[model samples]
Target chain A: MGIISKGEWIAKDIQYRIFEQPGKFDQILSSERQLSVEYEVSRNTIRNAITILENREIIQRDGKEYRLLPTKEDFETLEIMGKQSWRTQNNVVLDTSFETNKVQSQELMQPLGTNVRKVSYIRTLADSNTPIGIETAVLPTKALDDETVANLHYQSILLFVGKQFSEAFSEEYQQVNLEHADEKMAQLLKVHRGEVVVDRHSLFVSKDNSIFVELKSSILPRFSVIVQPDQDINTKVDGFVE
Target chain B: MNNEFKAPLYIQIESLIENKIVGQEYLPGERLPGERELASTYGVNRMTVKRAINNLVSRGFLIRKQGSGTYVKSHGVGDKYYFDLAFTNEQSNAGISELLAKNGIKVSNQILGREMIVRSHFLAKKLGLSADDEIFGLHRVRNIDNEPFAVEYNYLPGSLFANAMEIDFQTIGLYDYMNSKGAQPRHVYQRIQTLRAMEKEATLLQVDKGDWLYLIQYQSADQEGRLVEYTESFLNPEKVNLKFTVVKPSI
Candidate 1:
């Protein structure tokens, strides 16, 4: 590949510096103006340098200046996607919270309703410490009562349910759509009043008894989600004997 | 051009300059042509160019000073995108074709392929089709920006369209053609997901294997509630952006 542009290199440096300082982005970037003046360079070069940092989410623009935010959940997601490439990994992040309450059932859709209540803990990707996507779970009421569920570090609810109940998942139904981040979610996402986020809502059903598991992945448009084709054929091989 | 089709002359001039700046034709901090020169180039009145420059000044794309002429803004940044409801006007079959043409992507009939397959067990379950019924399978590749972005596989009952195969697939959108043939859709059930692009997918899309791909499947129905269209598209996540709105059902 071609050499990294000077503008891009400067941007990465700013991003590292901002992430390290956290909330001191404006101070660091504004200081670069002095350096530009000394080097006899136009302020445009400094601006280009800062633009790179903003795009990386290491710093965010706040009116005429920029700010730094740090997020733990967002870091972990990037760590996984970073395996793809440095550029692909630097997508935008939104942080937010969501609540699902049980209501009357409808013809087309319904909320999770089970006597053995289950509450899934999920996290979404974040940039500069903002929530972009989240994952929540629903289990029988009894599942939430587990001590492990109460105090755990990022519990994989699917794995927990599968091992405990011998429940093998059969097929998953996913609904991908877009929606405006709600006020509460928008605040958590750290976005403007009505920014758009991609919504990936999925329903996983158990093969044995047809139990359904729902998952939602809300994200900024920058990142892409990939899934392999589902090839689960529920047939008995022994029955094919001629 | 019609008055409605043409933007205000000043607005047009303003946008033209903005596009040049954003397109990097005029780099940041580059000096724009003088007012007299620009007026002669665009064949617009000088006052129109001045108004356009003033608008650009307020829009943060240009800077003006007492002695110096107009200069492109150096700090032009932050292209904010907010998600909202899908706008029908933003969507057009012809626009897609035009973009593809501009990108030099070509489409061929590819042997006029067709297949009669069993109703998808999945679709039969979603659309209430009979388990044993057969549906027409029509598959095609849509090119975008000089590369294939999607491989569409559509399944519909043969009875739905009398000459589904005979319809023009190149010049018109399949959905629009269906509507014009009296199969106007009222609502559709859509399922979207992301999947790893496999070898077959990679070859078809001209993308590397294991690239990220988005899959969208839809079952559309008419006003009378008859199932009319079932389409599944595997697309490049980079080429197209999906936008829609979801609202809570009123109690």
Candidate 2:
């Protein structure tokens, strides 16, 4: 979270661009020559920053180009959520980075101590760069392929699942509630401990009613989020009140 | 209808009857099936059905006719109806009033102001009208058990809904007025995000300055695709749930 070195700040700036303007930001990082001119820094400084970004997994060198890796951003996937026009697509969260681990979760409705893949990230508002929340997605390893788990850091998780395992999930459940951010949540979201935030829990269910993945998000309560159920809304009543 | 988000039996019943009314399956002023009959239809206890009907009545979505039967109110469109009024059954969205009510919570609205005014350039663009055009503006607060949770500023174009401000918004719902004018919304686009409250907004919502609240922005069009309404609502995140249930795709 601290940025005392020049190379690190340049790396942070590059990170901000990809997260904020994903559509225009090509996955390939600018060449060292191009970056030095654009940032008005020497080639060594640009190279150092590129190295730092590479180490942070923000970008991966594919031959000569550094391809920007996908952060845990909701808008990274366009097939499932968001509007046709990017202007109205609502997930305005810019994530700094995401980390993953394997842990046994009793919460997943699976066997007593089944190992699950958990992905955690800090979410900042794209426009403001203000840390607004944290999100954790715990996946029950029993139901997913190992390939999907391996690509978690390199690709958009939601997008990958939609492309590969869309048929496996047919129903989703989400609930939003309010709670004060605890110490760990505050540290991750970059807010004061005890500040009020909106906590959301989501579960995706398989066709056979088995749990697939559970996602938990805690965000500062500064914006409204519009959502609707995709089925069985039962809007048939047609009369108006006098 | 995932099990994890499944509501209680009473809420399901409430949703059923409310859906019928909103779907126009039940006409205005028409009597609803008796509690006993509904209980049997939904396969639940009559007391539970009674609770559902009573909740709708208290919210002015329905009324009791003494010896006759429970009937749909005809004066104004209830908040629940706004959901159906704005979208087709298959793509329908639930309003905040219905969401809170489903949880067995009581919600009420207070109209702070209503007036006809010249539209600003911003309003003009949003409503797809000229800046000089006059429009009806309504300001209101929604309270949950008398605790203020949202402040809404809604606008309606004068071209489509003439003399709309003449109707008392406090006594009649906006959808009711829209329905009478043949301007029932058929399509709506909404976006939700958060904003820090200022002094005036904080005082209105009874929250501290700089506290974050949900800012919902909506633009709805009628059957002809004419923009009829644009609204901005600031809501307290404490009482609302942002639920998204994905339905099983039909084979």
Candidate 3:
């Protein structure tokens, strides 16, 4: 990564200050001279910094005063993704229904077990009750108890299983494809037949290197997936899959 | 007969042709043998060869040119460009524009509209906001040189971006504006899928109906886990190539 210039840094700091005081955002700030004096920077640097913000429309000139514009709320520190210390889990079940079936496909199982549970569900948004996507997860019955299986309806099955079995896991493989909605998918997604949709297939491996779950999700149009590879990895996968 | 492996003949034929293409035995922009010739070569019927060819065509590996034989579809590598998914900075777009400019491509945005909308159920969930909350909706057509390349729709909570509707997005990028507000995105979750252009998208993108498009959905959150913005982009598959890097664990 490249370092940002001094002017850019100063601009970001000023913007952060403005965002911190949301109640005072609309209020006119000090004069340019006063700002330059307070920041202990040269008048030219202050002017350059202010220009950066002005171009972004974070602030507008009101006569001789600069007024902060309405913008997103600020935080003291922004999280770096690859180095995230903590993750906020979305565990709330908005509104969804699930159906359980016996696993019949050998590819869905790890060792061709018969007691695998295949759960299919349609996840919907809370406010409008619009279906977001359809997900099907296959897991070994021995890995989860009856209570855990029941709770999968309200919580993410992957999270629940991870908590119960191992401390960490990674997706082994993921494949994405574009296809038209079939009759059943159209009904579930509330779209007409032949509507374009996205299909995602993932395999999750536990800490012990055992494949515990295989999940397939079909997302409606307007949703996308992004994957960032670790910098240390040798092989890089890029571009649209199909 | 290989009774143990009951794979259909058409599927096997499809893979055979697919291998040839993947292995570069049949190069892109090169014509393939006719159905009858393929059928005789593979010891399959003409109908099976036709079915296999149709499957590959639908998969974007082949193209049928009118008044000409089917040819291996060019992957459009020369015309396509790669957008970095890992970079989190103000210059990401600037860098892309500069790179494209080096290739004699001018990138510009056509601002479609900017308005305040009540948060829908889907938008509320994605942005972690309540229904009925006001949000800024910014729509733009991303043009490559003078041609439309993609159409983008971005939604930001109005509480955070109070005067967003008044700002001119054509002059500055949205991410640049957000960065100026100290709300720069540090991490993004993205999903890439394929869909056919509908009537409205077709008109906006200057493509025919049912044209395959690459749909990229992105949600960016601040370091504090607060959702900042949700964007959905419809890209012309022929013009854009979405890329990713999947890393395997060292262990």
Chain A alone, TM-score per model? 0.44, 0.47, 0.50
| Candidate 1 lDDT score relative to the true structure | 0.51
Top model number, DockQ: 2
* Model 1, span A112-212: residue lDDT tens: 34343334333432234434354455543444455646432333444445445433454444445555678866776567756666675544545544354
Candidate 2 TM-score, true structure as reference = 0.55
Between candidates 2 and 3, the one scoring higher on DockQ is 2
Docking class of 1: incorrect
Provide the clashing-pair count of each candidate structure: 22, 27, 13
Model 2 residue runs over 4 Å out of place are A1-132, A140-143, A166-171, A206-211, A220-242, B1-107, B244-251
Stretch of 10 with least lDDT, candidate 3 chain A: A73-82
Calculate DockQ per candidate and list them.
0.04, 0.17, 0.08
User: In model 3, which runs have C-alpha deviations exceeding 4 angstroms?
Assistant: A1-242, B1-78, B89-105, B246-251
lDDT of 2 at B218: 66
Weakest ten-residue segment in model 2 chain B by summed lDDT? B79-88
Deviation from native of the Cα of residue A164 in model 1, angstroms: 36
What value does the lDDT take at residue A70 in candidate 2?
A: 44
Per-candidate Cα lDDT values, in order, are: 0.51, 0.60, 0.61
